[model samples]
Target: MAAAAPALTRSRRPRLGALERRNLRWGLLFISPWLFGFLALSVFPILYTFFLSFTRYSGIRPPVIIGLTNYERIATDPLFWKSAYNTLFYTALAVPIGVLMAMILAVAMNQKLREVGIYRAILYLPSILPVFAISLIFIYLLNPAYGMVNALLGLAGLPSPNWLGDPTYARISLVLIAQLGAGQWALVFLAGLRGIPIELYESAEIDGAGAWTKFRRITLPLMTPVILYDIIIGLSLGLQVFTSAFILTGGGGGRGGGAGPDNALLTYVYYLYKQAFQFGQMGYAAALSVVLFVVSLVLAGAVFRWARGWVFYEAEDA
Candidate 1:
């Protein structure tokens, strides 16, 4: 009976007509350029990199098959460990802080003030600015001698440290740099905030809930999905932190160049860049890239798994 039912359902399904087939062909033709670009530019490079990770290639010479040597080298590489630690530490600090700042901005922007539009524009402006330009600005702002940061510290009689020059503060400085793009995530958070039903807040208020209570009980739960998204995105970007570090550390140049003092700013991607371009260890670099890809996938998967416990869907409740 079940088999007959399946067959009946399949038989009832309409077949594509000549006109439908022609439309499908036209649709495929329209998207062929993007399809080719994705295959040629994105998919092919990723597959090639994976293949190269298993071989010894110095770019000029033909690649030689060397199974796991690069990965083995990475296992024992002190710089690899250092870069990994730095990347993780940066992500751990930056993601949470960025998320918090973004949420704050979103809440503030969600207010019913007449100038809210102007305020939002002003706040989001920094997120759109080029990272290179922002890094350059930070270079001057964090200058220990005469920078604005130090000048402000001096006014408050606080100690001023060489933000980029000192290893102890270099990573911290980069974490601070990561906050500049919080406005981008703030926009995502704003959308989530807007999507929350106003009725919930009204009901909370009628139940004698204050702002904090309403936020904690109503806003927070509803916003978990957006928060999860921001965290995943923040983690991905933070793990690949390179531009600001590279720029702040003078393009990783000088005596122990490419890594800031005591290798404080030696992010994983920066180290990979150094190996692939600066040192010409293409095979090792490819291996590093593969590891990063795996790590990113694992982290994203873990976040999604964790989110299942807390992420709320209005449709699910409905």
Candidate 2:
């Protein structure tokens, strides 16, 4: 029996080796593109940026060692504070509004209604629109004079503020514009909603649970992981808001740059860009990038930690 076992093992070794070699070849071939791209584009740039953060380098000149000077300067910079405040404020306002809008739309879409496919297409259309196009459209729409938004407000006898021009309304306008792109969030949430087992709903109904009760007890709890995912995405994107702010507020760079009326739309990325490109403070901008990276990491980590108590997983329950 022992002699036969050794013979069987020896016979299987060659077959296993051949199979493993074949799988290894295919796996390496499949992943070569991703590996190449990551090393060239992501890894090299990240390490280079870290090195640059400690040195002062303009595009025209070689980098000079300037240990912590940029960080010290940013420590006292009021513009940095203002931009941070604006970013956090935008995140605070936009995340909740976007998530709520997405959840509502997702719930509505989950209904067994006729022409559901058409409704989904119409609802998801905004998400597929080019961001530049959306920004341009909003700029035209928010034109206080002869704009569709103001024209509608006039018909409704409501006050129409200069959305992109006024300091108070500029930030609000950006938030509202962001909500127009909530179709992506809705789609994500809708997928999550569909993944919930119908049997759970049936069991809840059998227990005499009403719509609100089922949502609170079953739906909300089950959807916590999806909610966490959306919140992280929204917060990360919100903190790095640049394109819409830049295009909408006239893309410019200088000490006194295009930050809208009263610098209301002066986001962190915009400020960083101005520092790096306009003022020749590449080191400072790198420092700002580090700070933004750290803040995002910290916030995401906190969310993950907090989610432990609330984010339900069927595998964990099992």
Judge candidate 2 against the unseen true structure and give its global Cα lDDT, from 0 to 1. 0.86
Which candidate tops lDDT?
1
Candidate maximizing TM-score: 1
Model 1, 114-136: lDDT tens per residue? 99888788888888999988999
Model 1, which residues run further than 4 Å from truth? 1-15, 254-258, 316-318
* TM-score against native, each model: 0.91, 0.89
Model 2 residue runs over 4 Å out of place are: 1-22, 253-255, 316-318
The 10 consecutive residues of candidate 2 with the worst lDDT sum are 1-10
State the lDDT of candidate 2 residue by residue for 148-198, as single tens digits.
999999999999998978876888888988887898889999999999999
What overall lDDT, based on C-alpha atoms, would model 1 receive against the true structure? Answer: 0.89
